[model samples]
Target: MRRIFILIIGIAVLYSCRNKQTESNNIVKAIAQDTLSKTVAGTADVGDVSPKNDETVKLIQKQLKVLLKNDLKSMTNEDRYFYYEAFDLNNDKKDEYFVGFSNSYFCGSGGCSGYILNHDGSVINSFSVTDFPILVTTDSSEKFYNLLMKSGGLFHLVKMKNGKYPSNPSIEEKWKGEVPKESTKVLDIYEKKLEKYSF
Candidate 1:
């Protein structure tokens, strides 16, 4: 009786151990899937945006990586990274992507080792910032609106001209929330589209 009792307890311990291992493996798999989704859709950030399709998401990432690797090869910031967003700057229903890089050069938040790409994956323009634009969006005429900090820490509005933002933007107001002055409907639509694609 004693020997039988010991065997039963041993079997229970082994089964419990196996269940724990399986649970651990499942957790790892879930984490990996979440990471892949974030990388593919670029929607891990509530403040950012990206392509609404899987193919476009992968392509945008590849294009941005190539541009940063081959084009900016001379740079030497080990921590340098890129964040991209796909939006229709021209309201053409086609997507344009912006690749922003991390570097010490940006004195403020909106700065990028800057590259804005067209639908064809071609660069439209690139520029760095002293006080990076806190808000970047477009107008009905497709003009880019950049809200940035200027002298005396005042917030200001700068419009893009021919794919280039002005180096010296006039003060508009103090920095507000991240929301742009663009229509709320567009933001809402994009967020919904993002959810549909991600799931």
Candidate 2:
């Protein structure tokens, strides 16, 4: 009879522990959801830019995990933070992703790093020594919009050549020309806002 009592107690304890774990998991999920909601607040339903879209968000996060697999191992908690904005760079009415990392590990004296991803999260281009507020100009190359990225305190015109932007902006010529009319600045403070995301 004592053995049976001990068995029941063991089962009960295990069940209690599982319930507590489940509750903890739920709390974590709740916190994540709350953060996501705040991150996407005041954003319009234009495209997959909304973090409320769980599937798209999950897919983007998964791709980032794979893309930054090596860097992830050495990244500190601060380096795990990222920000992104979606814009139709190709003018297909579909948004391509512009993800930026601003932490010390990703930044240097020249500038930081950013990734331009296609609609499906495939990397279209990865640029080093790049500064934010990526400008989408009215100019076109290979049927895609040209970009003006700041590096070394000067704007570099990043025209799509052979289907990719220059991997390093520090070597590109400075943008001496005027930003075309109707051009938009993405990830800027006033317009084309960025959404903070934790990896």
> Could you give the C-alpha RMSD of every candidate to the true structure, in order shown?
10.2, 12.4
Model 2 scores a C-alpha lDDT of 0.77
Which is the leading candidate under lDDT?
2
Q: Work out how many backbone clashes candidate 1 has.
A: 3
Per-residue lDDT value at 135 in model 1: 40
Model 2 weakest 10-residue run by lDDT: 42-51
lDDT (Cα, tens digit) per residue for candidate 1, span 1-199: 9999999999999999999999999999997788668645533442333335566656656766675565455644543444455666565777766554444533355433455678877777654542333344334323553434333445555456666655444433445565453422222222343222110
Candidate 2's residue-wise lDDT over 1-199, tens digit each? 9999999999999999999999999999997787567435523223233443555566678888988898898988888877777777776988887878777998899888878889888999899998777778767899998888889888988888898999997787788977654566665623445466778
lDDT of each: 0.51, 0.77
Clashes of 2: 0
Best by TM-score: 2
User: Count of backbone clashes for each model?
Assistant: 3, 0
